[model samples]
Structure formats: structure tokens, C-alpha cells
Target: MKGTAILFQADQSVTFIEDIEHSVYEEIKSQCGCEHCNCKIENKIVDFGTVSPVFWHEDEIDWDYGY
Candidate 1:
């Protein structure tokens, strides 16, 4: 079984948004080998706002690549 879940961070707090059946979240978590997972079957749904930015660009900016 595979599913997806979303985690939200606001006001210095973390919360689980919702769970979807056989979703991308599950696949990602599984691939990451999450050690603290309880493997519980539960679903959650939340309503929020939707907005899009008007300006965005992709460029190879210099970043601190810790190596």
C-alpha cells in the first residue's frame, strides 16, 4: 500500500495536513526510509487558500554547497 501526506509548518509548529490513498507522499516517505513512522492508516483533509506568484525565474545562483 502507498499513499501521500502533507506536512504544514506555521507559527513555529508542524501539523499533518491530510492523507491520500496510494499517493505520492507515501512513495516519497517510503523511499526516504523514515524511521519514526508508525505505519498507521488514517486520512486527513484541510482547506486553505490558493495563490500564485507573478514573477519567478530559474538561474544557477551561487549557494553554499557544503561539501
Candidate 2:
């Protein structure tokens, strides 16, 4: 619980993450997501936005994230 965490919501937006224990991050990654989540890992439905699946699929919406 001594690291940073980035929580990706189902709405395709980040939660402006806080001090979340690393276990929580690992837990979320181990589950299969529902309809609201447009993510798939290992041919299974997982939470999207964790890795930003929207731009990955080309949803016709322009996603411009410049660093």
C-alpha cells in the first residue's frame, strides 16, 4: 500500500485517483467487466480505460492526449 494507483472508471474517465493500495489495483484487474465497460483482456470482458480501450478501437471520436 505504499505506491500510486490510477483508477480508470467505466465512463472512460479517470477518477483523479487518490492513495489507493496496490492490492486494490490488482483486484480490479482480476475481474471481468460488465456492459458499461468496453474492455477485454484474454478474450474476456475486463474494465476499460485501464489502458484506454476507446482510442484503441477507433470509435470515430477524436482522442487527443498530448504529453
C-alpha RMSD for every candidate: 13.4, 11.8
- Model number with the top TM-score: 2
Report the number of the highest-lDDT candidate.
Answer: 2
* Each model's lDDT: 0.32, 0.40
Clashes of 2: 0
Off by over 4 Å in 2: 35-67
lDDT of 1 by residue, 6-38 (tens): 433223333332334444344334533233333
lDDT of 2 at 54: 21
The TM-score of predicted model 1 comes to 0.22
lDDT of 2 by residue, 17-50 (tens): 2344454445554542534433333456644443
